[model samples]
Target: MNEDERNKNRMSNKVVNYVGFIDAPLNAKDLYPYNSKVGGSPVWMAQPPAKYSHIKCTECSGDMAFLMQLYAPLDHLPQFERSYYLFVCHKCNATRQGWKLIKSMERPRQGYNEYEEEEEEYDEDEEEEEEVQEKVVQNDTKNENGDDDDDWGVEDGDDWGLSGKTDNNNNNNNIDELLMKRDKMLKEEQAKKKEQKNNKQSTSTSSTSTTNTSSTETSPLEGFVTPSDPSNQYKECYVTIEEEVIKQQKMHGGGKGGKHGYVDDHSEMEEWSGESYEYVKDRAFSKFIKRINHYPEQVIRYGFGGEPLCMSQAGNQMFDVKTAYACKRCGKNKVFEFQVVSTIITQISHNKDVSSLDFSNLFALTCPNHCYDVGSDVHNDVIYVEELLLVEKSI
Candidate 1:
């Protein structure tokens, strides 16, 4: 019948599950079974004319992960094939669902069918004649070898033992010749394989030399060249600014029982002014002077536990800061501390209309066991921006 009738018949015959596990990458043609898994490379079916190009998470401003897709074409609307896509953000509880309609092109004409043609029936007499001819040929070959029952007792000019010896020698000669031919063929094959291998190696060496020459000719700008030594390669440091501040506080007698020790109670803490302000500001600048020179001044925010806060949920409400995970290197959960680099504050205050009175706080979690060495290839720590507000503006 028509496409719709065919689809209905097929659907009635079997139920299709549109869900699949993602273990590897997938493409459009690979989705033919109506349902399949996708990993790494997912086909972006939406064309340029569609509303949105790609999906993004609203909460964390991160790219959304592709979960599943569906394709269905109706008979009446055969020209327009609709595709449904589902995306999810694991860090945040956000779901982005949408669909796109792609215009289907006309299908090409099919070739001829062979099933409609008729076949001739077999003839029993012709088959019997063929079988008799095969038997006659077999008998003639036996006669030439003198293996027939009628010629078994016949007396030749030579002795029967001599005749048997001659036949054995002929068989041995034929076997030797066959073995020699096989050896020759095997040697030729081996030689051909060796030549092919040499050719491949030469081509590969030439290609590698060409690539190296081109790279050298390009003469990449300074600071952009990748280090040839593995030890010099860039790696992430897991150390946080909070841990550094605590260490400095202890070193400068600002820890517990010391004259400049900070109180545990938030209500007892003094406002930023005079000596307190200068101490904090100096500590921040000294700690992050190197980093300030290397990297640009910008706010990088991250979340750890609980549902991620969207733009609406991120107002004045204070949320619990999630505990940082264990050191990925030593697997030890101990010695983890929080610290803040004050250089960022100083840099921002100087650039903006911010006064010393405008207070802001940013903290990072760090491991104490020298786990923050970038050269040793340690895992980077997860740090979050807790607060960034002007006291007067907030009030």
Candidate 2:
């Protein structure tokens, strides 16, 4: 069999168009510190957003548990260091994001890469963990008899996935040598020059968001403990994404697939189909099932700014986003970033009562403007912005 055939899982449906599918679920602590992961407490980017230090459930006024963290730094908003943190309230399930969607964004530290020095310490262990993670994903391709679940990643000859910021912490070698390598990678270029902006730009006074006044406190979770609530917590797993391959697909209306995927005059159809919004919802609900049937195990779809595989017709679609879901910090319109599928709850915990977290999909809309900036103490401060997120329930 060719390499593509070799890597194929038992499922026949092939993932194409460079979409990121999370794989190799492992304990969050086993992998690199800066990588994407599900469950467990968050690995804070800089300092924890103080206001969120104690998030009470909107449903029951109880504490929330950490659900997952996605390391999705946008290229468009490269100056800011970014990561998405999800939390869930255990007291009441199906609260539809009554828990929270917190986004940590701040300018890069003025000195060296924030994670480089720390990550280097665990180079040997991290490399070994990655090997184990790969093996776990491979084993998932088939049953004991080795049949079924066949096409999980790029088909044909291509077989690599581009994880947006998975490799942010450049590892190994002399400290100086590692930093030198970062300058060469296109992805890390923005991070390198981010902290060089010494001259402070005038702050926006028109619509200033004072909720996240910059703080320099060390992460609160470092030594603190919360009331023991086992049901709210979940097992940890590192999320590794593989690229979906480009392929040909005959489009409706006598159209053809693009270089990446099929396209059409889909300005409106892309958002929703059918005449009435309710009918559009029915069409979307049907598609959701059919789509998940092929790759039901996908915990997340990570393609910031790219289209989110819809789980509903009204999933944050029926709104003037600027007015309804403006960025709490920048006051700019939030755009679709990535999404967490309900399948994640299956992998989140086996012991915990995850019943309260019911949803078909959780669509995260983030501020593409990325207007948050580090305070004078860039080395010590952090900016945590509350982003927009919505959950789609079963139709």
Candidate 3:
């Protein structure tokens, strides 16, 4: 049938119910009599096709039984308040089931006449056996030779009777050997296929179970742990930045505050301008300062939270910043890391609403972990101007 016609026919005669418990028969013929997709699965389940249903005949209730079969959609099933069954009317063949209920009647086997009509012809050997025996007896009577030729028939190796018997035995033996070899090969192939299927099913089930169990008991953020101090005793490898500490050298004259504290006008909090515009004009210069002259800067590593923001006589309070990238749908976090280039005192701007001035620095950030075009935009308030130095070299 054409695709459209097949689909229409299916829609017209489909039958289905919300079956919680299906009592499938053990016999293959009775249970799996129809091919269908159950519960949205492609693999076949034991159920009737969404087509016809058998119903009881109205005329003969119990005796001389007849059945009404319908090829229609299930919408017409009668609803006795909540419960109902649908079937074709045997008398009218209409799409409905009422007093004449649809019975799941057994299919009856066909009689012998239904197979082939004509009888097989009788064998002619029985009718001709008496005449053949009389001829044999007459021929046995010797006319001229005294010796009986009947013994000669048995003695000769090429005797027709003996040859026929020997040929029949040999044919039977050859047939038996051929059948045995065929059966052995078929059994081996079937065994191999069954083993492969079982192994595949087992492997899939095991991997699924393992993955679910592991995900349930593990935490994703347990990978990184930071240390409390900056000693770096526990860390084997670390990246250190050039930091300048004020060294109060003796003036070689009378002084106070531990032989004269280093007095630099820029140290004053109010007089200090923003780090970016005042300090580092170019990223290359900043890198040169870090390498040649020690300058206070940020340092980061695996265990390090991030940049060291402040250090005081009492103690150092560092700000730990961590970024977590994740997929919106799966909630699985992605890994990412970045480096900062140079900072400059580009300019100072006043707050439009407050009429108060604040220093803002634009920082260049690049991701070292990922293979891509790196620089990204970043900004910071009045603080230290830090920049990263990187060069693109073919690897």
Candidate 4:
């Protein structure tokens, strides 16, 4: 027998030990009775129960003390294409992904026919055709596997399967690295585009300035009513400076738990009448409360209710308020009301061209909540706005 045949023979008779499977050897019909083809191949039974100690989980270093099976016929080389086993801890099957060994099966060698082997011309054509077909199949498999390389990278690492589990911190690190790599690549691409844009702008500017220098001096601002107009021989042109109008754009509040610089106080705005106006006011307050919950600051004071009330848009801060209330079991009735004191909204921008600037709007308010006991006097508590709602504006 040649090497291939020798390997096949050894595998057929081999009795390698494994971790999980049936122990007894059953006939093909017994194991897969309903299968169309039984062929005479033997099917092995599952192995008996066994204990695994110091079974360190691949992800965690904790010991596993579950009973599992010992599989037999570890090498499925001759008749079978691959071998498989289960290293499952009965309690935690979520961490267990079965192990599979994809070993190559021995191919049967064609016998040498002296008389037929004389047709070498025909054999060459057949061999070439087979080689071309195998090449095509290999190329197809490679193309399919190459798609979405990022996702497949996780499977390539050593500590992935149940036998070699990864810890939470290591997994987090891997994720962070992947994100950082992606961000770095994106930044590099953006920088390249920006550099190209700057180069183009510089080239355009040089060409325009060169052309202007070659021609007669002509003021580009000739059409505008400039302050330097020579025909200004009349009434003093008082500069009618327009008061800046701030148009606010919606902003999502920051995350929870941080130092907040502002508090929510809307007591002054409460004086507005009518049901329709009151509804709008309440809506605004609700939106403000939602925004505050997202702030990163830990020291934010909302109204007297423990609910998170407001958020500071600019920095590390959130404000929440907790009101003092009698227990629900108490018979006396109590009422709580909140009021706003002073209010201010401001917009500031650094850009010279009004249309091109990135500007922000801020809203500041001072509010107080008054609690009245059914038969007693009123008690007042103040919630101050320390953080400004620095919101970006358009136009």
TM-score of each: 0.23, 0.56, 0.17, 0.19
Instruction: Kindly list the per-residue Cα lDDT of model 4 for residues 96-188, writing each as its tens digit.
Output: 221111111112222223223434535754575566456444533443555212342445344344235444555545555645665575567
Q: How well does candidate 4 score on lDDT at residue 335?
A: 25
Expressed as tens digits, the lDDT of each residue in 28-133 for candidate 2 is 2342324566765666654454455667777887777777777665445546656777887755646564658877755655333434543563574456556645
lDDT at position 335, candidate 2: 67
Candidate 1, overall lDDT?
0.30
Q: Please give the distance, in angstroms, between residue 88's alpha carbon in candidate 3 and its true position after superposition.
A: 32
- Residue 306 alpha-carbon offset, candidate 2, angstroms: 3.5
Model 3: per-residue lDDT, tens digit, 222-295? 11111221111111111222113334434554655445643422123223234453242333233333332323
Off by over 4 Å in 3: 1-166, 214-395
- Mind giving the per-residue lDDT tens digits that candidate 1 earns over 16-129? 211111222333233132231222222322122122234456577554444333223334333332222333344542111211111111221111011111111124334544
Question: How much is 338 displaced in model 3, in angstroms?
Answer: 63
Candidate 1, residue 111: lDDT: 10
CA error at residue 127 for candidate 3, angstroms: 44
Overall lDDT per candidate, in order of appearance = 0.30, 0.54, 0.25, 0.28
Error of 4 at 135 (Å): 36
